[model samples]
Target: MNINRLVWIIMHVAANIKNYKFSVIYLLLMLIVSCRRSTEIGAPVVNSSNAVLPAPTKQLSIVPVKIDTLVNHPVLERGVIGEWDSTDVLNPSVIKFKDKYFNYYSGFDGKLWRTGVAVSNDGISWQKFVGNPVLAPSISDWDTGYIAGNGTAIYFAQRIYYFYQGINDRGIANIGLAVSDDGFHFKKHPNPILATGPAGAWDSDSVGDPFVIEKGEALYLYYLGQDSVGVQRLGIAKSVDGLHWTRLSNNPVLDIGAGGSFDENGLGEPSIAYQPPYFYMFYTGRASDEIRNIGYAISTDGIHWKKISTTGLISNKLRSEWFSKVICDTTLIAVGGGKWAVWFGGGNLPVPAENLNGQIGMLILDLGQQRDMTSFDANSDWSRSLVKSTDVLLGSFEIEGDLGKRSTWLGPKAHLTLATTDHAGNSMAGKPIIVEGWAPAQFISSKTGQYEPLTISISINGKIAAKRTFVSDDMFRIEILWPEIAQLLDHTGFVEMDMSADRAIVPAQFGVSKDSRNLSFKVTRIYFH
Candidate 1:
């Protein structure tokens, strides 16, 4: 086969793997993929013979939510007597040790920042180590000052490694590694595993918040590198033993390039979770707070990344919430039984004086919420649609959950997505496509701030047709614009639509009704036309 055919075949095989089960077969296939060594045309040999394929792509969590959400946002440890966990809770790293959970954190102790430990039965509630401050500043000949900052945490077989930022008295930030046999107690390394970046590199100034992940025998470290300009970017290095590292001469594994992009300002605090065929990373930056913001990017190999999207993750949420100011450190844990917990450290308040004494509070992850996101993606695979610049789309999801469980998508804004595909499922960029929905319902669509009898031309495939320039006051009609949508139309595809054009009344109170209880809300009824 020609090289191009081989490449296309590989891509085709990759896209379909998302449909199978995960097992040793999958791991062997993944190993073969990892061994490819190069993404180039002549990439190394891949064993296609009887290799167990990767699990099928069930769904993508384009949107995430808080589930099993903790009412008391910033969990306080009983061992400590302070509020807001003392104000910092800067870098929160959590791991599941058998059945219990452990949280390793880095906060200030009045004078300087250091690391500590806390225990938890359920992730929501935590207890600080009576003998707190599991990992502190460095005083060895190698580490001169303190554990400047932290990155996401990970658990490996018998050892727990918390990658942290070590800043010397000279204020030079470098990456350091600490390990623990048990989650509560830790031992710091006498030598910094990875130091500052080369003089003319994107991380010329310093490297901080190292996130160490072990992939096979090689341990890949993802961390933040700062240049003299103070612009923070992400870099990657690999090791076989989690010590003695060799920098990817072509460092700056990730960076903000060109215009005022969502990730333009910078991408720092690299966190990695070995999820299937790829290693996923969540980085924070200036675009993190944009109303349409949520910082993210993906990678197959720890070195080369795939930008699923440039737009930020978890955007335009809680602008007023206590921790609304930022969305940093996206942490996820597959705590068995298919539950994923993602905790973030982003609040508006400054580090309190009390917190300066060593305590900090940040947002917690609701694994149930994450599971819902997975279900949402599984339930409603996302596809894009296009409308005139002045059009809006109204849509809602009917989710069934046990008491105290709920799911939430990131935003309601109808994204004007234009991709390079035509109605025939082939690349057709810069070509016009209709923007109509099979709105089988008579109720109005949420045509907020858009054309009423909206008629517009748009290019790109306009993936799944879920949104349209329509709305209704009466909640009677059911909408089923799925991801694998049918083509846009002009005829009476949508039922109960305003056929008369303007002289029609649409209901607003549509969708499933709810019954509110003392503790939670439940969906009692689902209405469909």
Candidate 2:
């Protein structure tokens, strides 16, 4: 029975037995104490006076959340129309000018890959340029046989400079440059700008998949280089005028990972972004399984790198039917709000002639909230803070890392409660406010325990508004919708959303071992429409 009903019965008996009032009163007190203890058996106790309290409920927690890896569906597919790109389309490089977005991509016409242009207003639906094959192969030069695609474009000095990989009759790949006044039509340079390295060098085999970015006055070119051993790695080349170039001393800036690691076999297909004090490099890591996925690393300077993870960020599992085994040739452009749009090439293996085509795919990454909350360094401000009624102890968490960063372990009996203010900066009393977040069960002891559902409670002001439960296969991500909370709003003042999750616990030798569950959610990004 519930505590309320049980208390009522105890009180009724005590009133009728007035002669034994002292005995009845004593028994009632014991029962109430036992109930309270049972309810809080595995829960952590908080000492309000000793604990450092969280910020006021009106102050929204700025904790970062992971980006939805599956947000980008195939915006552009190949062979939807049987024209110049009748077979396959791949390697997309995008630039936004004014209101329109331009995509320079490589397409195969059953013979050789050639460069093409497509334009879009919303960056989703695309219309191909009528004059397709803006950059094609030359019959008598180094790029004689095929203009093998992977093109990187930058609008600089009032002109668009296009860099691509060109293959000769001997099947050797070299970096070539092309110039265009408008984004559609382009003229190729007479000779290869960067050829293969000398014998016994790391990049002696071939260098392709050029990614160019203007850092200050100089332009840095990052590309994939293969050695005589057939292992692919990444290398950097610098240029002043975006034409003449010099390779960095540490030729292969990033090599293959350790044996049995995700990038153990090779690392290639570099895409780089320079944001503030850090330069992020996202590349394709090939494993022994021959499956290719996207991985990332960060560098203070463009030459030396610290890998974010040994595994790939965008793996083969994220690939669609057209993208059976590989997802490489990444190109990233920042979309506002701490998010980036990544475009890459994806294709299947055991190549069937009818389905041998590769297509361009897109995925998004949010760098802002990618850090783990379980562990921290001396500089962390979150250590030893009280989250609602739960106590958080610093230096007491298990260490783990994901996406190239260390993950903080939420202890058993720990809970994260965060408040959010509406992004519209108005009352959401009548209108529905959508809520989404990831709440996966962490650190399960048994196989079945992994499927256990977690509870989510949403409160407004100081009163409970809505509650729900969800079980997710993706332990790293989940979403919840709350319409009931909307009905409770008054539509006058700012709405404060207080979100909390129960402590994640596992069985122990004596009783139960409990840990805090990381609760990261965002209210500003959710929209009703």
Candidate 3:
């Protein structure tokens, strides 16, 4: 047979290989044949048949991404020395209106915070409105202290509803509403829409940083609630007429992070976006060290939220001089193709809020789109890296860290996502995937004194890949040979191992330690062969 015909036959058979071992052999044969053809075609011939495959795409990896390269300065800078925003220009709430971007940001004039407007045609180059400080503190009203623009401006019913934070003379903060027919002009409501909770309530001290989005028939507002003890958390409220809001019965939907976590100190400045089946939140997380960064969370119903990780999604990796100290207060805009235009506040000084030399910056995030199984490239090979840790795209884990001697446990359900390889979006479909983890067989229930065995189910994307019941207290290895027809990772290049157990157990019940967490299993490592 001709060399070209032999190569064609090899490709045809290799594409249809079902068994992993046979598939590996065919892939090696193709590499050898390609090398020979390269020499014949006057191309550089790679003699070694063991050339390693490329790693995951650089775009998917976690690294220091630069700000808008076109203009490496703040998209919105502080005003002149005596202007309203002379001290700080931060906490931007941006929305696209009629093909233009309207940013409502908080401005500090060394004394008080006021709302200012900056218009942008491209969401990058911003021009401050001549009629600055569009919303200022009332002379003697409830907002006599300051008017914060660190809130949401949502367009609904041909009118823009701007929810903002207002402080009284006593330094108490509450959420207020303003109406705007034109994007620049506004009229304040008579009274505060969402007030502080009752004394000793979770939000008795303050409720600010409102992020409102309209769902089916009602509007959902996510905001930050601070208690009397200075503990801040995230909560949700519902509104029908954009003025009157009812806090969720189970308020403070999202709590602060665990001890030693990125958000251990507090959480605030929530900005939400919808990407179908999942609602994403980009909020500010303050660590115990007083360093702040942007954290991410996801939800299906927008009421119940699960944080993706203990680490911040957008950290101070760039180390830019202007934002060298902290990065917080996110405002997101979906700019198509899984790209989000995120405008946030950064500071060179370490102050958490108010005046810290705050400036506005922007970054673009490319979160891949979900694809169906029918569109998967069956011919692509998986990456050569066989071992992966929990650092990359892990979700619902009880805490963050490596699977070291000190156990890293997952909650009742967890997901491990694998990005497609760099080569033509290589996927893990029809590949031999293995996961090694440790799970306690049974745990004695503290309340009833009954033992509950671990029943775990693993899924790829949404398809059940493996399920097992562990009665013996032993380390387990789950190997699933995913069928080619099940193109699980085709969409979004993600392999979601939806691990669930019958029930989670606390280590304190086992006399293990003082730790109290609902843990299902310990995922040590994942391998693809």
Candidate 4:
């Protein structure tokens, strides 16, 4: 039989089989047999059932490399020195002046908290100012009790302006301003720049954690406000001269998370940084679990905000030493090489004594790395939409499983569409994109007739670029890669997905309490790399 005729028959059978992997294998074998018989006079007849196929060649595996974000250097640990910072030190704010790195932190003697200064050439090793407690509490002033040792500092108008939180005799926290000429000694202003809001306001109880950034001709101060109900939120105020401030009409710009959320309890200790088109806010989120971890949010304008993750970015799970109790009072500074460093106060244990006895830890965040673009987790900021058809409903779903509660549902016949521009911005084009995730096969089988394979198709610019059909009787992991598309660079496009049963099917559970049309499969994670 002619080799061409034999190859055509094999391809026809493979197409009817509906298995992508087997079809590719058959094609390769046909090529091998044809190349070997090129010099022969007549085409060799090949047996379909007994023909020997060469062993498949292994493809080179490529491992992705990620830049290290968090690099820890405990430059301000307690008990390392017995000077003015002998007892405890927390709340670190860093500023660069001329050639040295100025580290201003809060220190506690046996009695009260006071502000102190330490200078370093490289930001690691530090030497306390000869006259420590550069700005101590005044005997007869509003900030007599305590002055925040670790607060925000900036150089403007040929002077250093330190913005700190002061607790008065009534224990009410308020914002204060101090001016430093030489970056060492600071002179406090007469009155509190920003006092607590009116009784019944969101920030009625107290205000603290001042994070200031200069934009345009005005300086914006973002702080933590505790209400009479004890719910802490974020509020903003603006000042032109660095002393007097006017609170925005939309006070409490960021409120507590939804019920049963990571920051559901309250929010506190905000740190803000401006990186051109976006301003990043890092703060401490208090969850109902009694866990306080670092959370992140981003904003195009200083007022409106969007959280980066549903859960805390830096949690006890990330660092075992910090235990899951406390990680707050963050100060972010750009370290220049497409990286940012965060200095925050963390406690070793969850107890109160340990909380008060905190130390500063540093972590770096790589801005060049790819981040998650989907939010199946209830806590993320990604918006999920549910699409309904006659037989099935699809999108992010909530299902009860052996694990208390899970949000892994990707409804049968579901369509998931995400904006690539939001995650990649202008740098998306020409970058290698990988879509990888897993789903529970048993659940999917139960819903779409019985153990039928599901087909997933990815479309770029409304054109189907890649498709895969996989059986899901067990845990199914799927990864599809698309090479760089030059046209996608800097342009906005939708990465659309269609996940449906291979054949016409009905919901697995007909009389279930939940809507059958709403039943979905568990989608572990769907992200681009």
Candidate 5:
């Protein structure tokens, strides 16, 4: 297929979803309401029984943005980072390590395209790697056609393994593999491991954008699956060794709705991060029928998810005039502790700015502090003792090791409660319990500053469970009660306070619960007499 035809194919496939994820055979009986039938390259993809492709959405339209506004919002303030080279910096996925930052992006020069890798020490200043086009098209492999636009969901293990999309000679986009010892250099798979859906399926038209991650022994693949209608569906799969895979019930993890809403037209390019028990997925979606915006979703298990669409995370509110569609290739990096940042390729697709500098942009998300990410087992040495500041401590409190530690805090029923006093026996309100991964911390300033959600989770035996999440008038005292924890407690669990987030929180009355969202922060101290 020619480059222009390929581009149109993607544009067509995303807008029409009625038959997107079903089999071709099913399409034979249930035809699309509207298909923008054309022969840019040749005949369209036949449905099962060799029927014609589904009709495109009649109301489909592209509202291109002005080059200026979109580029300024992201981190590419220094320069367009080689964006002027025609290698559309789409599908921007970046990872940060101890010394340098690595960026993996799609090089879509209007036609033939594939994935590339770049590096930087400071998140802003970048240096493209020698192995620039790290994983380009190789017709000799299963990805026979010219390769282009792709997405990868990743996990940090002994090495980085990525599952991305590659098109074949027939214009079919399929998922393939690549592995890297360091973040920069990569080696592609000898074959296309995952391919287009069977003749009659939601993903039958073509498959693109594979988001990969690992949960313990099982490796999960989250990707965009499309049907002839062009509508996009979020699909998923599981693997044992990260190489071979087992297709789940051919079910979509998520899909876009139709007409006039956030994510109404379609959803594209999924970026995900495991903030402990909860997995947060961020992707691009159309809003108000014309504009594209960022949508958010959270999941405890990668399979089941809850989407929050009432309000989008990013908006044209600040730079409305310069930003048209205003979205693409969202790449988020959590710089250890509790700081978070997101970057993406932005600019007017057909329109160029003054310097033609309309390029990459970043969304700075500073997640105050991080919480403890450890799962506790209350069996080894379960000891609970609170230190009632023998001396009024400021900034730091001191409790010695000889303060009587116990291996068993009264069987399976172990409870850890804490209440703080400031030299005088009184309640203290409005203390900060710093946290992570979440944005717009729940704080109320009208009443001496209040913290809304004080959720914490604990592990019992081998199972993880929630411990506490309640309100406290004495925010300083941080009233914590765990009678149930005291009753079924063991000695394996340890007492620690939250530290990832940098808020001035009272750790004395802190506790844990079975909420997955508690992954980004940690506990440091407990206050008890």
Candidate 6:
């Protein structure tokens, strides 16, 4: 049929077909018919069904892909044996600007410690700036002794604000600030931004190790506070502009642990990571033996905090091969999908402070896939608003529309909570179940530069139940068998899934959609039989 005749027929049929489904089918048929006519006219024959369409200005197709484990070793090592930073290179503060990772770390040159800058495309490989010690001690100022130890950087208001520790010749340490447009160079603020507390106060001796988090309308700075009596603790300060600051009335937000606890000696290097309702703190806790390890804490308002554990979160037992002796100076970066890149300082020689062969290392902490689903798709049953009443509480998922088919885009870690009892209070202790879903097509890994096979894993109460390591990515009507659901669910009735590929991608980064959520594999429907 000719183009005009084909168009006339489609319009007439679409108007008469009252049912929208039939109208859609008729339009598809018309597309095929027109393509055939083009081929008959000696034009290029293209398969409309399989033809690639330009990405919408907004909204991207969710894809199924996984990333290889990032480099866990020390990405930024100490300099050559006799170089300026030969002794140790630790206490890293990193910020991403202009598509590059700028790591500001303390480099110990045996006699002096200075702050240096290193650049990296990926957080894994780093190249030290030829002009090292971007921010050194001002020989004639209060920071005449050295400028080093736990520091942090943040890009705020189109500028990089660097908070660092500087000690003077009198052995007094205080927090200083430096502004940088480019990550490589910096302009120091004349005087110290934060100094010691009043005499006899908790932080009278010195104050340093400044870690800042942009909370709400202001900037909350958490730091290490030392008293004249040689006791150390953690405190919080508030600021609107990055320059000025004020300490909270209730100083020392997190004090030393109980008499024989892990942090009895002191606390330093506080790092904050916010995941919705809770703010997580990872700090260096010191013991009586002068041993230092990473401790975990949680807070609602940035000023108040509660320690998560009695022992250190990462102590000698949980230490990595290279950082076995000491671990301090936490620099946390969230790489999406509930995962945090904890870049820290570690050393071999056991010491409470600096110069222990200190090197920078990183560990990825997957806090699980739970995200606060308040405003986003509130109508979805899987949302936080309605999930309390459901039998299976999904960590994260989305519905097609107001009332359409539901799909769960499983992130690196997925969590499901089963209701042990029904609304009528009837026990549902033991029950077999089956989950049906659909997987997505495989894709190449941008991080590892390799193609990864899909893997689906089920864990019961933190223990691995089953794992399809190399399953076909095209697996449809996927059935996950749970023979004894009761045995799987913990006392609190919690279970976890590692079904999707690790590392969810942000659609906005690829210019696909304005959606900033880190989305992963597609599970069209998850049915519990």
What TM-score would every model get versus the actual structure? 0.52, 0.57, 0.59, 0.56, 0.55, 0.59
Better of 2 and 4 by TM-score: 2
**How big is the RMSD of model 1?**
21.0
Clashes of 3: 1
> What digit string (tens of lDDT, one per residue) describes model 3 on residues 1-529?
2323322433343344300123442222111110000010122212122111111111122212222211235778999999999998887888877767899888888776778889877676689999988898888877775455666788888888888877666666667888899988899886778777776878766667788887545677787777666677777777667766667776777888999998897777788876433457777777887677778876645666678757786545555678776777788775543446678888877654556688888766645343221211212121322212232323333234433333357777664554334223345456677767777775434432566666888877666788888765668888877563145554234454566777676777667778677777776556565
- The lDDT for every candidate, in the order shown, is 0.43, 0.55, 0.63, 0.55, 0.45, 0.59
Cα lDDT tens digits for candidate 2, 1-529:
2322322433343344300124442222111110000001122211112111111211122222233444234556676555666676777888765456788887776666678888876555678888887888888878775454567888877788998877666666678888888788788887777777777877665667788887545677887776655666777777667766777766677888999887786666677864322357887776777566677886544566778776677554555676667666677666533456666766775221113366666656655432222222323333432221111222123334433343443332222222123222233234454443345443332332444666657565445766666565232322334455444444212233445655344344314444233322211122332
lDDT of 6 by residue, 278-366 (tens): 35788877677766677877653445567766777664545657777677787876554445666778787666455678788766665
Per-residue lDDT tens digits for candidate 4, residues 364-439, read 6544323233322323322231111111113445443444333355545454443344332333433444444454
Candidates 4 and 5 compared by TM-score, better number? 4
Judging by lDDT against the true structure, name the best candidate. Answer: 3
- Name the regions of candidate 4 deviating beyond 4 angstroms: 1-67, 80-83, 315-317, 320-324, 351-355, 369-529
Model 2 CA deviation exceeding 4 Å by range = 1-65, 80-82, 315-318, 350-356, 369-529
Candidate 3 regions with alpha-carbon error over 4 angstroms: 1-72, 370-529
Candidate 6 has its poorest 10 consecutive residues by lDDT at 31-40
Better of 1 and 5 by lDDT: 5
Assess the local accuracy of residue 217 in candidate 2 as a C-alpha lDDT between 0 and 100.
Answer: 53
lDDT of 1 at 74: 44
Regions of candidate 6 where Cα sits further than 4 Å from its true position: 1-72, 315-317, 369-529
Native-to-model Cα distance after best TM-score fit, residue 10 in candidate 6, in Å: 54
Q: What TM-score would candidate 3 get against the native?
A: 0.59
Q: List CA RMSD, all candidates.
A: 21.0, 26.3, 21.2, 25.9, 17.6, 27.4
Candidate 5 positional error at 95, Å? 1.9
